[model samples]
Target: MSPFKGKTGFKRILNAGGYSLDGLRAAFTGEAAFRQLVLLNVILIPLSFFLNVSRVERALLIAVCLLALIVELLNSAIEAVVDRISLDLHPLSKNAKDMGSAAQFVVLTMIAVVWALILL
Candidate 1:
């Protein structure tokens, strides 16, 4: 039987939330980095609101949060796929995970820089 066979009950739950919802659950479940990033966002959001930022600045801040989450989710996916392929520490697999991590770091740096530029 094909994996994509008729609607399973779990599939229905997944369908209800959509892609972003899946991303969110994945973030909270398997990704520790995402959990920390979310905690940071929690702190940052209220601070952003209280700081009297301009509308553009607020928009940029929102953009940064979304970017951070998206990048982290992609990184998590890469790591998951790599691990699923082989649990051994192959150099190429290490490189793939490292590159994904670096991409997340770059996104985080962008978020920080944009927030600083807007607020300070």
Candidate 2:
């Protein structure tokens, strides 16, 4: 079994929360793309509320924006793990990182489509 796998209950929840916050802090500090998306979220999330849309539409807008952040975090995690394994310019490592980037790009495109449909 994996060494990182076995925590349960309230203690697990607390530990998980701490780990998640640390991941966010690491991503915010280490990834410029993450920082840019976060700044966009800071403006867009609140602006989403004030737009003349139904509650469901507002939620969809906000959710898609947040999804971009989620994808970015996952991408960052993938890159980090790949780098941790080796910094060498291996083809597989490059492919893994590229796939993560493509995932983020797709999510960003989805966010744009959702926002345009709801707001315009």
Best model number under lDDT: 2
Off by over 4 Å in 1: 1-20
Compared with the true structure, all predictions reach lDDT values of 0.86, 0.93
lDDT of 2 by residue, 18-43 (tens): 99999999999999999999998999
Structural RMSD, model 1: 3.5
> How close to the true structure is residue 120 of candidate 1, measured as C-alpha lDDT?
76
Q: Top TM-score: which candidate number?
A: 2
lDDT of 1 by residue, 1-120 (tens): 877556669886677669668778877987789999898889877777777878788877887887888888889999989999999989999999999999998998998899888867
| Per-model root-mean-square deviation over C-alphas | 3.5, 1.3
Error of 2 at 85 (Å): 1.0
Which sections of candidate 2 miss by over 4 Å?
2-6
TM-score, every prediction: 0.80, 0.93
Query: Which 10 residues in a row give candidate 1 its minimum summed lDDT?
Result: 4-13
